[model samples]
Target chain A: MDRNGLEKQCLEVRRLIVKSVYEAGSGHPGGSLSGVELLTTLFENFLKFDPKNPKSDSRDYFILSKGHCAPLLYSIMAFKGYFPVEELKTLRKLGSRLQGHPDALKLPGIEVSTGSLGQGFGVAAGIALSLKIDKKVNKVYALLGDGELQEGTVWETAMAASHFKLDNFCAVIDSNKFQIDGSVETVMGVEPIKQKFESFGWECVQINGHDLKQVDEAYQAFLSHKSGKPFLIVADTLKGKGVSFMENTEKFHGKAPSPEEFEKAMIELGEKAL
Target chain B: MKKYLALREIYGQKLVELGKNDENIFVMDADLSGSTRTVLFKNQFPDRHFNMGIAECNMLLFAAGAAISGKTVFASSFAMFETGRAWEIIRNTIAHDNLNVKIVSTHAGISVGEDGYSHQANEDIALMRAIPNMQVLCPADALETGAMIEYAAETKGPMYIRLSRETFPVLFQEESYSFTPNQAKVLKDGKDVTLIACGRMVDFALEASHKLEDEKISVRVLNASSIKPMDSEAIIESARKTKLIITCEEHSIIGGLGSAVIELLSDSYPVKVIRMGLKDVFGQSGKPQELFKFYELSTEDIIKTVKENLQ
Candidate 1:
């Protein structure tokens, strides 16, 4: 796909995420918008495995460790044909496979059930280690919410991954700044994110998350580096990336967009017939 | 009934074997290696073993990451310490998502003896059994404990198998005894009444049954090592055949074997069930045998309970 087409798809995902929440009446939109392009790049390029064969042992695994931001992950997986894109509307509804948190038991694309923060890195590290041991070169990707660094277990897992020298693993922290309650700066400063990673012996990279070229380059660069350290990419992102009203706002962290806001978002995304 | 095995010895040996064959099997200790008997694994496979200088939470989370990477990690610590200190990490990191981790905690029940209430973890089963996707095992002896080590290592998801510091007789042979996770073993079956128990309590239950048999009261003794799966089929059948039933364990009556038996029985066939346990009181510092007698967890207590039920 061309760069413009990929960017368009990412914007479309951001709009659909707003719409899904507007329809569901409850969902996380803040981090979802921030992660749209990354998820798009992952589904379209970096991650292996045909969506037709979700359970193939050789497939590269992706875990949205900040799992509450299911809107982005669900959108990407549905678009990638892991499930019916229409089912994305049923997210957080009773009996919907799209639970408030990603359930590996319920969803084919989800590798492990994760909602509580800071622990997915541990699980992803394990999966990466397993792949490496089996001689399968499929990389394991896990995305974390920067606010989740308040959880000590994440750092604990980070140390173990670095100690074991898991180069097959790559973790992306969505530095959207705001958490459920407030901004990470006020809540718990996890700044100097790169230094912390370096202290833990991880290969650290910082980039503008909204820039698709940077996101793509980071992926390619991570692959090329044979450092015996786990790769951590700290992406600086707005809490809500595209829509003006939602940008950097904690109100949209877990709230559904109103019907009026959804219309404006869809229009901004250039959706046709809707 | 006549014999039981101390699980710590077998836990050590089985870990060494697991570490030898599977380089992916990692063992983490929290400076309790000598007490928990995980020293054998550490001695045999130094590379795969880690002692994290008394940091239980780090040990648990690190193990979670290691287990995720395709390593079967056996995390060893004192029963009360690890289960209490690092429970949330264990629940969220390993068990909640169903990571393959073997949580082997020694000094369970009053058997840790002179260490007092702080060291002995009577509530270990209770805490572990509450979590979803976690299987709780309390092996009757060392042979079964060794067998359980391999079983838990092979099984997917989180498993907690309680062990004891004190050594007892080797109940079953290392070569032939079969132990399956969540499957209760019927050691001595009788028609008069049923006595269900786990861990060190199984030994007392057997001894009580022997004494009762001398009085011509045939008591069925079952080793309910698997606490979570509860073996409802065996429990119901036993309840139906034996009109009176008694449950014995080293933990509190609130959430241990006694409570589990009552829950199963009340849900299905209501029967006369008497619970014999620590009765929700904290233990004291003393010799293990003295604590057993003082706390009424001894075989004599079971024998006395059986006689009272008969009357």
Candidate 2:
């Protein structure tokens, strides 16, 4: 699809993020709304998965290391025909298939269970390593939170991926500035992120996360990478991109909007309020 | 009549044989392949072996990734790193998903001599047993170690098998012995008192029973190897029959074999139970035998504890 069509899909995903988190009455809207375009670009263009046969051995795998952004993944996967789009309403409810965290056992189209910080990144690297052992050319991709990088396991697995030269593996740091308490820098600085991955023997790319054209081109370059090193894309993103009231603030990092605030967010996202 | 063998050596040899028969068997080590004896499998099947460097947490999750994708993966390291350091990763990825990964950890307990308390893993049994759907196994001798390895491969879901670094006297004959999961093997039987032990401490229990026999005190020695889904019926029956019970192991008495036995009998049939092993103390740097003696886990310690409790 072209840039105009992909941008439309991103708008729909952002609208769904506001609706789902508002209905559930608790979630991280900041990260979920911020990851809309990256999730749209990956699922719509790059990821190789059959919604019906999610357990297919040959399909490309994706892991959400910042799993609190489950809304972006769930909405995009529903659009890809993984499940009925209407079922997205039951998210975080009792007996709902959409768990608060992505549980691979309960939900289809999810490659692995991921909720704890920095764990899914390691799992994705391992999956990439397994593919190399089997001599399969399939790729593994993961989206990590900038705040989640504070976890030591992330760096450990990062070193393992480079040491093994997992060229088929690719990761994107959703470099949204705000975390739970405040800015990622003030809470615990993880600056020089690009140089860190480069020093670890990874080919690094910087991109405008909200721009669909840049997101598409970065992934295209990742596919053609021949450096025998894993790829890391540090995409600069807004913590709350579509919703004006919540934009660039830590207050909405984990808070659900009120009914009146939900109306304004739906209007800003160009969707009808309930 | 008896041969001494290192459990790690037997595990290394059995793994190589198991790998030859099953192409899907993958071995991962956290740079401890040489000590854990996974190096044997690495030498034979270089393509299937993965040296995950010194990252035990990532190695376990990596093994889970392989296991979920139709592979029987064995991840190895010292007990401290495998169970202590990477416990949450094991619980969430391996145990929660119920993946078919065999976490075989060696150098357990004070048997990891000269490495000090940091290298010893006395709390691994407690740590693993607390997780849901995790099966914990501690084999008594070399024969049982090989059998348990094969059994773990055949069984589905996650398993934690503990092995010691020091050599232990073989208690079972090669052709005659068999392993049944969650079942206790009655090595010897008598009526006066019951002696239950696991891992390297089983040999001491046997020797202690022989020394007690001269005093006309008949002792029953049961090899309680399976720790998690323990032999509750055997323990309850022994409690009813003998009325006196003594539990032994090379690990801490707080949460090892002794704790399992007491937990079982206290509910069903309460009896006078004496636990003989390391108390609430970490092991120090010493030879395996010297450490065992210092911790009061030798044959003399077992005999002394039993005789004191018998009166």
Q: Fraction of true contacts kept, per model? A: 0.43, 0.52
DockQ of every predicted complex: 0.33, 0.67
lDDT of 2 at B263: 88
Please give, as one word, the docking class of candidate 2: medium
Candidate 1 per-residue C-alpha lDDT over A220-250 given as tens digits, one digit per residue, 9 for 90 to 100: 8788988978999999989889988889879
- Model 1 alpha-carbon drift over 4 Å, by segment: A132-136, B1-5, B18-35, B42-75, B81-99, B153-158, B173-177, B180-183, B189-193, B214-218
lDDT, candidate 1, B1-311, per-residue tens: 34545578778888888777888788889888987878998898776777765667767766775665567888989888788888887886678768788888988888788879888887888888888888888888877887788888788888888888888666667576898766777888998889999888888898889888898999998899888888998888899888889999988888888888998899999999999999888988999999989999899999998889868
Compose the digit string of candidate 2's lDDT tens values, residues A73-138. Answer: 888888889888898889899998888888898998887888888888998888888888888988
**Per-residue lDDT tens digits of candidate 2, residues B1-311?**
67899999999999999998999899999999999999999999999999999989989878877876678999999999999999999998889888889999999999899989999999899889889999999999999999999999889999999999988898899889999999998888989899999999889999999999998989999999999899999988888889999999888888878998998898899999998878988999999999989999999998888888877
Model 1 per-residue lDDT at B9: 75
lDDT of 1 at B112: 82
Best by DockQ: 2
* Index of the highest-lDDT prediction: 2
Give the per-residue Cα lDDT of candidate 2 at A173.
95
The window of 10 residues in a row where model 2 chain B has the poorest summed lDDT is: B61-70
Backbone clash count, each prediction separately:
6, 0
Judge candidate 2 against the unseen true structure and give its global Cα lDDT, from 0 to 1. 0.90
